[model samples]
Target: MKNKFIKISVCTLALSLLLGSCTDDILDEQSRTVYTPDYFKTEAGVIGGLTGMYAHLRYMYGQAYYYNATLTGTDEATWGQSADGNFKDADLSGVGNLNSSSSRSDVLWNTAFSNINAANGIIENASAVGISEALVSEARFFRAFDYFLLVQTFGGVPLDLGSGELKFNVSQNRTSVRNTVPEVYTKVIFPDLVTAVANLPDAGRVTGGATKTVARLHLAKAYLTYGWWLENPNNIPTYPETPRTDPDGHNAQWYFQKAYDIAIEGIDNPGPFALQPTFYDVNVATNDRNNEILLMADHTESSEIFNGGSLTFGSGGAPDNFAGWMLTWNYTSLVSGTTPAWTAKVSSVQREAAQPYGRPWVRMAPPQGVFNNTFADKVNDSRYDGTFTTVYRGNWDKTTLIGTNPVLYGANGIAVEPGDAIFSFLNEEPSQPIDFSNTTYNSGIGAGVLPGRADFVLPPSRISRRVYPGLWKLGPYRTDNAGGLGQPNAGSTRPFNVAKFSELYLVAAEAAVKGAATQPGKSARDLVNVLRARAGKWRYSNADNAVFIQDNSAAAVAATPAVIDINYILAERSREYFGEGYRWFDLVRTQKWNELAGTYTICGPNLTDVTPQTFTRTIQPFHYLRPIPQGQLDAMDMPDADIEAYQNPGYE
Candidate 1:
């Protein structure tokens, strides 16, 4: 809050100058010239105005470290990393922090709002100056997008609809708590998106590209999120997370249909926006700015500068130095404990698999006794490869198992075990299973090992043989995949920080499945297969494909597809977007948030076993709205907001 002017608030200052006729005064001097409202009257200005909104977002997301820590890691979820207590202490109380806007801690907060302000400014002034009519829609859509981030992250926030209000109400007591999810959908989210759909020009709506289609995508998302949030009193979607029960749940169907309607309308025809169908070049280190990335903020330049570290990751200054789970743990790339070296010791979760070496720090694993078989056996799961890659030829061959091979190596690789002095606190390991030709136990004599046992019992050292064992190399991080597994030790970029478009696809796919779109098949079952096939999963089509719609309902999803099932769709959302921080909000929308509500633990294997999941909130039916900061809450009182309660009002 100290340097509120640091990039974010500077947005307000810049915008104010635009609305008033005093813009010429700001440009009074030629050398110290400032681009005023009149300046943006040109094509460059129009582009720059849009660019300004986009610039705020580019500085916002995508560091494997941040993705892991905040989204999937202990920062938000109860992934195993919280087991020992290293990060996100409040969320993972013992290890996380509040005032430490350290990395992207508040990036989502400031950037989203700033972008929103800029967007509003663009919309407010673009029309007055006669900027392209198309640009106005794009601006409005983007402004809505910024609002989406705010609503999703902090729940209901003050609605700053236009550039007219000249009030400095940044103080807490100046606003209200939690806007109705419906109100948000009807007003801010829907209007802008609809305007986007009509006014967003024909800007070559490429795959990763933004255009009317992108507007449609978010609108669909807004509908789905809104319905799901209000599905139940607690915000726990009507759907259940386990084995997919009651897939239909509430008015999810109605919303899903609307989502689909918009998606189809945006395209007008199928041929154009069809997926590019090219395989993901997993080798592309970063800068995955291809058309594949739909609706993303432009971070192409930042994405390409890949290395051992980023502003999103690190500890005590050495930069690249990190904790392991950053790659595989938190997000649904894999469950921890399943892969040996990538155990709770490596991540904090027990069931998630550990990435070979594409390490971030907050590796994802599951609870102590929970086996991630649901996720592990998804060999053909689309998210699998997107999350972690397959490295070896055969399955785990138990007999020749050493504790060093990557998770992909057959036998001869590291054997799995439970956490303890022998394993990790998360408990449990790979069955160290053997490929069978009548129960074969070897990696055929020349095989490898698992998480490498050198540090099997150590206090989590970085270079432990067991820690960086052959298990890592066998992963998508096979830095030498192009070298055909022969060359083992080159520090590779692609081999680090595993990422896949699968996550977003699933988001889109489910959006479709839930009636959010008009893909060829209206059911999620087919989409599931599409994803599974992409992950190289075995023939995903099941006997139930015919009855998928019927089998999938609010009460049950037994391989049927007679009708769309939102809960089942969500189950996939969970499986596909796990650890990606999808659950945090998914819980809210589906109204199943109570599953993660109340007291929870961050449990870690390195430090204390349990840490509380305390966070700032507004009130019941308003819990999703985060509390206003105490200082701001106190300063702005009476006439507007409830200053007294707004000041860190959680205790009451």
Candidate 2:
């Protein structure tokens, strides 16, 4: 009644009926002020309950819980010193050190359950009020979404489907007993989602809201994860030490076919969906709710939500999207001025507007392994440039002087010449061996020839700690409104994409490799080529036009392994979905968690300095499933035996 932000208690539902009686009186003021389980039986009440659940997601995504839990344990990123061991126990080599007491884990588990519980309320009370099938289906979609994340993270959890009455059963809440991963999927996730798919609106749902196709997209992904969970060829509890074994009754082919069929339906069904012609076009701020995104978590700058766009994580401001802030490079650390002395345009009124660009947290960075190993042709892969900002031309106007004296443009003065190459990130690290004559750096200041020295590339003069390449994909939109002179708390307002239609291509390709059904006139090769061809077109047509950005021809597709193996598909995903928080789940679902984590040399800025030189710890098999948050285990009102039984296998 009072806009559902008012927190309700679980005990309220269980005791609601007991507080009611067969009495009719004007003294029933309690009914107007407080919500009982019976309130959810009404249409307005059901909608309020659903709105509260959605609002919780907005808050949860704004927090560090989801990204911290998912991003660190993968190959793409590592827990840097800035995080101060936030997810370190889980991400580091001493896998056994991670126990049930981790606060971050506690945050993730509790936040998700809040949404799951809210969905249960809607489903249980819908029939009593005769709620529409579509609305109930929306509630089911959210329930399945929460359970999907739970099963993936915790393996098994209490399967609570409110039976007949909204008792909020204390026993169900208190029990630490866990279900099997398969049981959770089959019993809870699959059924609810199937109901969601059958009953949700057929089309034209809002971008951030649940639609039939959105349900189908997740349902397909569930099938894919299920296929791998059964007889996971790569699931060696201890790998290299232990041999890979295909478990009995692993009908992977069956599940892959089911996944392939569903994915193809989503892709081929006549609807408003197609891959954006350019990778940049797909993710830019103007395209926040574009056709490419099947589902995304929406955020706004005006709302008192999280952190602002350009400002780093801890700086005081209203709630803005901190995801971009966390991944952004420490811009303030780069330049040598207290008050920013650089302005690209001479007559600019917002001359000091460039200050916000220096406000990033620089918490995490993309692993160098991806640039070297995954991007076989990063120069031509439109995604590389679309995703990363490799060059930083000086925006400081020449007239600005430093050191309380007149400083000129050249020789130690703080003036940027018109053609200066302020920052450069080579495709290959300088320490690695390479052939000299043909090697060239696309410094955006013409070709940079490799120097004679073997220790590093480009003189050490250009290789300062401040020159690291920041990810541009999640950058704060630099519009006049957003990039105003003193736009306080102006940070990211972009939607965080949860599912994209382009990912379906990769899914379809992987399913095809695993002996599943394929789309008509579309092989795995064709699907990958479509994306590549789009990349090639963008490379040639875009403004950053340099000769190095070549197109992927038919021959390139033929040579590529996307037509043959899973490794290339994983590699392509690394290229496409870098900072979108897709890495951990992608690696886990594919069973490549241990292998890639062991193989790749992930590096980040050192603890005391901004040098991109710290290496990550090797990953272990137990990392396939995140340890149950210690707080959950401590909070559960159960015996030690039940807690022990419920804890995932390797975490103990």
Q: Pick by lDDT: which candidate is best?
A: 2
Q: Which tens-of-lDDT digit does each residue in 477-506 have in candidate 1?
A: 322233222211222222222223343344
* lDDT (Cα, tens digit) per residue for candidate 2, span 552-592: 65544555663467777887788788877777788888888
Model 2 CA lDDT for position 335: 33
lDDT of each: 0.38, 0.55
- Which residue segments of model 2 deviate by more than 4 Å? 1-36, 60-62, 94-96, 161-173, 236-250, 302-320, 336-358, 395-421, 429-467, 478-491, 539-559, 602-618
lDDT of 1: 0.38
How far residue 556's Cα lies from its native spot in candidate 1, in Å, is 19
How far does residue 628 in candidate 1 sit from its true spot (Å)? 3.7
